[model samples]
Target: MTVLSDTSIKKAVLSGELSILPFHDDALQPASYDMRLYWKILISPMRHENGRTVDLRKEPNHTFFVEPGRFVGILTEEKISLPLSMVGRFGLRSEFTRHGLVAFGGIQIDPGFKGRLAISLFHAGPELIPLKLGRKMFTVEFNQLADQASKGYDGPFQNQSTFHKMQKDFILNAHTTSLAEINTLPSEIASIQHRLTMHETFYHPKREFPSISELAKAQGVSPINDITELSGLLSEEDDIDTFLETVQKWRRGNNNDE
Candidate 1:
């Protein structure tokens, strides 16, 4: 098998050996063809479920943001078809890769395949990646096989129409969890837990409060040795009413002594 040069690639496309719709002269490269971004996209929802997305074709904007630390699926502007004798290899354009965009896709296009390419993109960069419609995002190089395989590709994704039809938008451990929001979840949970702990310490700190016996000793009262009486007053817990009564009585006795 030999890699097809630009001239050979053009000849094959012209002769129907390789089919690409909406091909542009500018997109033709020295040894490959550029694939443009299509209008439709399904982004990882902003911390939400239900895949609930919008079609960019219907919207006024021609751009979508590949948010930082999130993944998105997009379609190619051109439809592709390849004969069994030729295999294609594709990758994200270096322009997009320079900005921390990672594209997940198969390395080779199986023969006898026809469909719009679905590229899943992840933004590992710090900022949003604004991708415009019709932008050339991928470069695909074709190679001619010396011998055509016995069978053509007939997998589940052979003739997929849309990105959604090709694969799931995102796979997460929790169904209600959103991959886009995964970055901020730990901080949010920590904040809530801290607040709850602070509230509990401020309002209900029985663990830190002294017991009735310790209070009696501090006040110079006699060693009230009856466990039954202690239980009656404390009731297996710290009784605020009992604590208040005991303090009041001690204070009154101290006043008398003064």
Candidate 2:
């Protein structure tokens, strides 16, 4: 498979061959853009005899809380009709990962697979990164397959329109269970840990807590709400840390105390 070049990315967007998400304030670069999660998601209430139990279409008003500094998988509303002769898969934008966010699934593309995309996102940072609805999180980069493979992902998730959590079998495995015993596990696990810790040190710094009343007034919202509620379920220590840093930066009071 050949990766899509920057020019190809632009051409695809212009030709409607690829869907371009809403541009966020932080999404200008020479290469790729970002995408955001929808407000609601469908969660399975219980496991039934077969995997065909819960359907997202059946539930309309279902809500899933997307806490700041966390991850969620969402389905894009747009659909792609790939010609049978061509095949492609999505690639995660590296900038998002640098910002302590995840945008990759299994990184697999099936031949003859035609449908919308399901994006998986995870934030390993401490600070709350606010995301607005319809904002871009990552751009889709397509690769051309030399020859279309026999198997494609056409069964369950095709033409999916809503965000739903993956099945239980998807996450739990030898990787999740016994780590030390696996021969190849130590280096891979260590590498992931190293990257995560490094990201926390650099990008996910603590933030200062804004005064709830002040924040409410500034945002032109209600003041009676809990400060935490207004803060979107993010860790409070991050805010406090930011506040402390800002205070230290401007500790020299010129005329206020006089």
Candidate 3:
């Protein structure tokens, strides 16, 4: 089996023997094509727990932070199609390895395989590693088979293009268990309800507000309750400071009249 060179790969792509959707000519390397990270990822959860799927595109900067010793499964941005005479394999880009990230998937691509590649990444560095969307993270190399296989690969993960949770039932159960625990704490719920009730009672707008006549009676002054008077005073002022001074003078006159 001979590994395909850049020229051969280009020829195969043009001849319809291979297809790379959303291809970029600049991403083609000497003997391989660079593959970019997709927006979706599967985060490996804690021990005895179920993993969760996250879409990095929905995150800030379209990025995800993976702590040291954490593992994540990511998908490739490009969709690939291989004919019966060709197989593909992928490896981590040198830049990622330099940052102490280990990529462990795409060891083999069977003949006639077609789909986006799923990459398993582990952060082996002492510091957290940030994986960004649309970054070139892996290199895919194609190989020509000696002969076409008798049968093509049609396994369960054959056309897996999106991130999927492996233990979906466990995630559902964990969510249900959390709700059950919260429901059993009636005292805590009651305490929260009481606090909310007290806050509502204290801050009721209608109860806290006093009418202009009531305020004037309390201060022993005549109420300047006419809207037309206030509007005329405001219209006569050229600036905010003048308007404020006029209002203050009006208040002082009311206090003097009392």
Candidate 4:
């Protein structure tokens, strides 16, 4: 795919072919844009292959719970209208990833892909970041299509307005007997916790729990009321590498579950 240049991206933005406002990047390169995180994350139940209902918006604004190593999808403030010939993908910045954060999602827009673009976002980190609504999440880079295909994403997810949890219902109806035998639930929970933490550390670094005690007060971690006790628990763990790896795995798994 041919990558769009900074100049072309600006042109597209100005012409209304691509929709995003308050564009703030020094270079304005198409390889990446500086995106901000949206505060409101919408979670939904996974769907079945036969198109049966698993969830019916039972909880509004209560999307997926992003923990470490989970891949949850969310939308963006910017709405896109790609040309019938151009397609692209969204990628998370490395600077954010180093902090144990990862983001992904952008479908292959065919030659006839139309309407506003929806991003499939996932976080694989160690901390939970309560993303606000209407926040910029990531920069999108456009790529040229190889002779424009015919098929586009006009399926169930088309014209999706908010964060679409397209996989929730399926999980709810999965085979309980088989899932229990394989020990799935525990692993899934752990993954969500891991990624959510990474997202917190990377996207919302300043807000991470100051110490174990502070973390405990929150639901996931232990509840250590005293600062001294929290400090002691942190000090006891010396292997930084092990800790990071464990968190990362958890976040990735969380996304897969969604």
Candidate 5:
């Protein structure tokens, strides 16, 4: 299969083998055609803005803001129809890619497809991007298949002239969280953990808890395992661990009858 040049593309259009409605000469390239942004609208869910929809039929604003991290869907100004012998490749212009515009859609137009393209896009730049109506944003490159496919394109999206229901739902229920805020969650969690463990260690860090072994070393070399010795040492010992060890020594000696 070979890609169609601008001259060949026009011939195919003139012959009714390919279709590009409302076509403009300036939009044609060496081997592709640029599709302009439709004036219908761009919907972004904004906690700051009062509403979620952008019905241009009522509103006078012709431009939409793609804030950092918000996902939005847009339509092309032209409708396309491809014959069974022709297929197409699709993507956004490189100029928009440099500004951190990520375009999302199927890259291939199946043979004999007829539809207006609806593209999902996100602005990932540090600042917000304002997109005006009729702006050139997408490109479609037509190519001729070696032979006509045995079958023609007949998918759920075929003859799609407007946004799909799924696309509408996405805009209707978009989350307000920005990607920038999501990135800092790990550090925020780490800070909370450190706060819970702040300050000097409780009691002593030498051992998990004070034991009879620690007491034995503090008072004398060997344990005082006699009851009479324990009663006298307990009266003098002020520390909790020392007092516990004094009682333990007497209990061990009595149990073993030593």
Candidate 6:
């Protein structure tokens, strides 16, 4: 098997031997091309037997946050078609790995496979990770097979270009566990509800507590809605840690004044 070089990959794409819809020349790397994250993702519900699909496009800014230790399935933005002569290997980009995200599940594209790749992403980092729509999250490296298979891939996953729910039978049969583990759904939901209720009681916008902007103003500082806006307010010489410390001091002063 020979791994395709950047030049060969471009040639194959141009000659119609390979197809990557909505391709961008800038996405081409030295050996692989970057694939962006799509808008939809599948996540395991509190119940182990059920799964849920989340569409980030329905949310503001087409952004979704994945909590640490959560596992979700995402699709690639580009639909790819591979001829029988080639196979594709998918891998997580280094940038995401640095944030402790690991890609799991189907990593290899069988010859003749045609679809947007489905990827299972596991967040192993300590902090929540934000995934933005259309951001490159993975890379695909194409390789020429030694010989074309007599029969092309025609598996259950062929042409799976959208978020797909895991079949119930597949889940029940694939992973066997004790009855206790299978019955934790109710407790999990209750726990989640309790946390949400507490959060609403303490921090909901409707509560009497002053908004971040109001607090900032009371402390004689510009209001900051988010980390991005806070960063913008800082000079190049000002480090984020120092700025955050100053904000904390101001917040404390405002509380004392109150």
lDDT (C-alpha, whole model) for all candidates: 0.77, 0.50, 0.76, 0.53, 0.79, 0.78
Best candidate, TM-score = 1
lDDT for 228 in candidate 2 is: 60
Q: Write the per-residue lDDT of candidate 5 for residues 44-68, one digit (tens) a residue.
A: 5654653255544344466676778
| TM-score of model 4 (CA atoms) | 0.46
Q: In candidate 2, what are the lDDT values of residues 72-183, reduced to their tens digit?
A: 4455544555434345555555555665656647555455555556765555544444443444544554566687656655767665554334533332210222112345
Which candidate number would show the highest lDDT if scored against the true structure?
5
Question: After superposition, which runs of candidate 4 have C-alpha atoms over 4 Å from their true positions?
Answer: 21-27, 43-71, 102-107, 115-123, 128-135, 146-153, 168-258
Q: Which regions in candidate 5 have their CA more than 4 angstroms from the true location?
A: 48-51, 56-61, 179-258
Give the TM-scores of the predictions, in the order they appear. Answer: 0.70, 0.42, 0.61, 0.46, 0.66, 0.62
Residue pairs in collision within model 1: none
**Alpha-carbon shift of residue 156 in model 6 (angstroms):** 0.7
What's the lDDT of the predicted structure labeled candidate 1? 0.77
Better of 5 and 6 by TM-score: 5
Position 50, candidate 1: lDDT: 41
TM-score-wise, the better of 1 and 4 is: 1
Give one digit per residue, the lDDT tens place, for model 3 in 1-258. 989988888888899999998888878888999989998777766445666777887989998887655577778899998998988888889988998788764488888788888767767766667889999987999999999888888965677786444433332233212222444589889989999998988887356678788888998997567767666544544688855677787877853431
Task: Return the TM-score for candidate 1, rounded to 2 decimals.
Answer: 0.70
Show model 1 residue runs off by greater than 4 Å.
Answer: 45-50, 58-60, 164-166, 169-190, 205-219, 223-258
lDDT of 1 by residue, 1-258 (tens): 899988998898899888999778789999999999888776664455545454666655777676676667777889889898988888899988999889887868888888888877777777778878888988998989999978788877777777544456462211333344778888999999999999998998767778888998999989657766665645457778766877887877853431
> Over the full model, what C-alpha lDDT does candidate 4 score relative to the true structure?
0.53
| Candidate number that wins on TM-score, 4 or 5 | 5
Q: On residues 7-93, what C-alpha lDDT tens digit does candidate 4 reach at each position?
A: 778777788776555466553654655555443343322322222221213323532234443344444555555675677666555
